[model samples]
Target: MDEITEGTSQVDCDILVIGGGTAGPMAAYRAKKKNPNAKVILLEKANVKRSGAISMGMDGLNNAVIPGHSTPEQYVKEITVANDGIVDQAAVYKYAQNCYEIIQELDGFGIRFQKDENGDFDVKKVHHIGTYVLPMPNGDTVKKALYRQLKRARLLISNRYMATRLLTGKDGRIAGAIAVNTRNAEFLVVRAKAVILCMGAAGRLGLPTSGYLFGTYENAANSGDGYAMAYHAGAGLANLECFQINPLIKDYNGPACAYVAGPFGGYTANNEGMRFIECDYWSGQMMQEFYNELQSGKGPVFLKLNHLADETIGEIETILHEVERPTRGRFQVNRNNDYRHGMIEMHISEIGFCSGHSASGVYVDDNACTTVQGLYAAGDMASVPHNYMLGAFTNGAVAGEHAIDYVNEVDFADIDEDFIAAEKERVLAPTKRDDGIPPNQVEYKTRRLVNDYLQPPKVTRKMQLAQDRFAETRAVMENEMVARNAHELMRSLEVSSILDCADMAAFASLFRTESRWGLYHNRADFPERDNENWFCHSILSKDDAGQMTIKKKDVDPYIIPIEDEEKDAYDKQRIKAQA
Candidate 1:
């Protein structure tokens, strides 16, 4: 049990939730629901006004239900396959089984989804399939809905609040957290019995990929903050190495972030301008399940054109204009590199965004509880279920429910205010005064390293040299990385950022020993998916001293029964998915 000391000026609460996004709020909301007397607080780095990565208007739940074709079992099966068989099976099942309840719970609130003429939930409209997920809405609708619930529950919600680190009581229990109100520049020390980390993955943060080079959805502020704080606070983390990359993002031109910007579309064009498909019908060549097309010139490819002036161009124009952000990192691409010296902007059409959506986070058992006491994680930050809409909500709800249960079990006691005050001063230390190097400068260099060294589908000997150079350059930056205020804090963050994710990624890359599918990780040295020795999930963990170690957690296909003769069924289902 945790309690705040009397006259503890700045600290408050029974549970402190980092992130007011999808999973964080649910955890906070559910925590309060279980213990009415418990004080719950949610902190968001940005506004609670919108869902960060996937947009706020449409929470795209995977709605894959057919008459008798799909079940939770089938969905789980497909999910594991889609993830390349490295998922936590129990966690997936728990989430899959209870996904509908989460959606129904959401619907019970004011959040609405599309429906058919029969007046049933029109989930399929939001997602391509409906078996596992609710075909959820975006952050605008989904986040606001969650916010409404958070408000109704009276859980304290703070926007633009940055969680500096997880706070542990003298008893070694994770009692709460330390944070800064980014807007007011004030330190906040929250003492709680439990803490939930719901920040998404380290993948989309311009991690070594086309997102850095081509501008695919990099949420800069996120910067693996949750993962860093957790690691710093002695929280056991797993799968830090496996941040999923989007295949479509790689194949697209212009800002890669626009890949998932509008509706799910994949318009792939080759150097010679040819269309490629997940399952190409024009010929009989089998579409490689997941391969790197960026350098191989064969992985999943999306086309880039130079105009969109047709009759129905209005729709794409509307979405594109609204969501388009300028490209910055590696490709410094304006309207020229993609179209070539101002040839004219192109509207990617026909194809849709494909999934390379697995990511890494905290290792949780069936209950989403990390090895650390009184610590919980959900969504991308919590390990399990990487980058899909349906998966996020499903697992998020499970973690939320379990977190509340954990919160209620703990008895209330007094928390130490002195520790919190000290934490606040530490967080304010960086900002109270500026480290010489701007956070962006360090980030840009890091992004370049990722762009050159990590970005793959293996180019050539030159790229290998580039990678070596990247390591050397990054080492210097980290060695000499200096900071003053927030920028200084960020410099330290960047240093940890590379090691935090890179250690995991580097180890995972080394162990897999082969470039399996094109999900960000690529080994030019070994360019093939070696199923015999390495067809497994790349599991990573940090020890008490923050040393990263990687292991292979193989997927046992036997958990869900399969007919010996029905192997074709698996292939068929996969084919349908690719289609």
Candidate 2:
């Protein structure tokens, strides 16, 4: 890292991966492996060793298409139908095709996976129609394995830097990005031939029920940076209205995680301790059912494990407590709740944008290439439709390898000084303020507005009203939000990203008039799925007049056709009682 002059640092690389999370590390590693001599820099707001969604480590692979258990074509069709037949099948298929290879690669890196006594991978069924979940009893060290590989690859790791915006060339190709150090508040300008945006999901866009600003289902650091940067860089966002809402532990804000407990006979039960929905997979339809259960006389949902034998409950507890949000066990213990004797209470999580769980994120093709030239995305931020952790590694590698080929043909583009100067002022304005509203206050207000106006069962007028309130919030943020130090500055910048995401969510919801993707975009004004009018992807992008514009992109023809019998399989998730 070289300093260009005072208050600014200039770094040059062949490829700039603007996230150190699940996808960015893999992307940087793969890019370097492909070219060897090419400079691949992985930038992170926090340390690479403990960051992103997997910082605490994952319990298992959510969408692993292992051989003999599930085929790529079957996995693709499952995701397509689960997403209400609105997915780009090619993209989902691409992830499925390469995910097994990625799993093998991770295994070689010393990450442990649950295997049967026959020495074969032990996969479980968690989705509506396919087996996908593969548990990792010792999954806590996943990041350690990745970190070892990243060091071996010799990729440049720049941590504690929060990327503010992307720097595009005159021809609108991605040149590089502008970032600010969260620790020292120093400005960084990286010039690269290509850039990959993997800044996780917009987790902090909605206020969690706990009232803690950082208490979110996704990592708190993932404050919609990638989505905001890509939008400003002229990239189209897909299905922003298809928000990610999970059934999490009430007040704790961590997942009840049916994927972990479902295979061992754990289920979501209403107040009566009886199962309602047939499946526990995190889909829009499944969430709709969960929401409906909460609205009914049942009122509350719980992870029903008390019915299981003590031995079975112990196995589930060992996996759940030791990995992927270890705090869940502690939170439970603090409440005097034990899996063997009592059920873990569950609640619907606050809304956010995440393609890792639902299908709303920056638009990308099968190759992980975004609409903008030289710009790519993967993981939660990219629209690959229910592409959990495995998709991140698979698509990250795809983005990296393809970017190497792209950079081989293109030269580094020049960034404009005027743009950099304008960005510097915009970024530093809060720090220079003598006194104004604090970042947390503004963030709370902004997210509170999100919960108030944007939590779906979607109404047309409320969504329109959300845009107006968001506009007012944006104005207040610009004028009055102040940060006293470098740390506060990071939070201030995140508020801007959160507001940008909130606005996009409302705009996209309003753009599509028909109800689709279950509770995700269940428009009350138009209460039916209008496949004839709204089957296409609703794309959100910045127009030439510098305004957010909505357009429809037709779904790509499915290479693996979904039969009529399978199209509505998810709609039948509710277990109907016999007459």
Candidate 3:
């Protein structure tokens, strides 16, 4: 480990795993285990013990394919339909095939899962057509389990260091990355043979409805760092227009836990206490229905659990309160609303890019390799549609193990000192200024523009205006944004990432030209799905001339074929009225 100082410092490692969240730890652990002699460093902007999306832990596996309950083929087809057939089935299939082993490994790490009396893994139905949800009653301690594995594997962990940019070699392969200490603003250059990015999602791209900046559905720290880094590194990002929008608690902005509660006789209902959608699975179609309900006279949807028996409600509360967003229980109590007597109010979440819940992320193949050489992306940041936490683990392991093979065949690329110097100057510029626009103001305005112009039910003119406004916001961030200290500097840097994502979101949404993923890319002018003109994956990247470009990449042919009859499964989420 290199000593920390006021000046720039450098460290060399065989592999550098960015983001200590769900995927990054698994990636680093697998890399180190593959070759005990290799020096693998897991870099996190926050402490490994409590960081990323699952910092407090998750409630359950959103897409678990345990043997008896579900098969990899079934899971692949389900995700394919859910994503509107614009999926890389191969990538989804790979995650499903390997996820069972990853679960067993996590179980070995002392993470507990809900199992039946026969010692069989307890699986429940949450999706529209499959049984995939596997609960973790004691899931709040998940991060602790991962921390233990990382230490036992002897992988070096670096906390409080946020990477700003990727360092590409002369040959355009990944050379290293440049990061800054969030505490002291110290610039540190990490040179590595390979790099794996698992930096969650562009969660903070949209401002919460509550007017709180940090109150987002995804972790607040996941401010599109990986998305920005990959774009600058010249990697193609897939389906940026297919944004992540969830049905969350109103004002509180936490998950309503439909997966956990739906299996226990809880459901999403209108004010009339009538169920609207047939399934609780989160898809764009489902969100479209949710948005419609909010717009209809039957407005203000609720997660209704008041009809269930006392014991069932108690079990639901125990799981929902103890894991995932534990603060959810407290929030309900603050409102004086109990599940036994009343329903939890729900609303549509603000839009952001996330492959974990939706299908917008850095493009990667089945093996987790990105378009750039020696660079791999997994977790929510990577483009495996609807790949929840278990997908993060499986893909992280794949990236880590594959990177080892690549590192063995190559030598360390030369680091350009001039590039590092330039980045250091750019990163530290805000601190040098005595007074200017605060980062919070710029971020607030940028995200406000995101909601105003880029939020779905998208209009072309508004999206065009979004580009103009974001450019202005970027100018403010670059020229006038000021930071009083290192912490403020970190926030300032995050503003840049958020702006990049906001730009990509607008650009990709306009390029698609059709309303494909329901509300995710719903163009008001082009209000219908057009498979004839736009049926491929929309790829967004930074072109050679240093400009953002959009192009179409053909979706991979499905290995587990989907019949025409099954392709419209998700489109039928709204329940039909009986005579």
Candidate 2 per-residue C-alpha lDDT over 258-360 given as tens digits, one digit per residue, 9 for 90 to 100? 9988999999999989999989998888889999999899868999999999999988888888888988889988999999888888999999999999999
Tell me the tens digit of each residue's lDDT in model 3 across 386-453. 98899899999999999988899998888888988888889988887888999999999999999999
Instruction: Give lDDT per model, in order.
Output: 0.52, 0.91, 0.92
- Total clashes, candidate 3? 0
Model 2 RMSD in Å is 1.9
Off by over 4 Å in 2: 1-6
Q: Stretches of candidate 3 above 4 Å error?
A: 1-5
lDDT of 2 at 568: 96
Angstrom error at residue 108, model 2: 0.6
Writing each residue's lDDT as its tens digit, candidate 1 over 1-579 gives 111112322666667778765667677777678777877777787776574554434434543333343566765665555444556677767766776667677778776655658867643221222232333333235666666777788878787667777777667678777665544455566777778887765642343333342243434444567776777667656544344443333324333322322233323444444443332111001123333233355423433433433433433333333332312222324323432222222222111111214445677766878767888777766666533555556665666667667766785444667866666544444343323444456566655555554444434454445546556655645454554444345344444554445434444455556654344445667766567987666555666565756666656454565444532222321223233
State the displacement of the C-alpha of residue 48, model 2, in Å, after optimal TM-score superposition.
0.4
> Candidate 2: TM-score?
0.98
Error of 2 at 69 (Å): 0.7
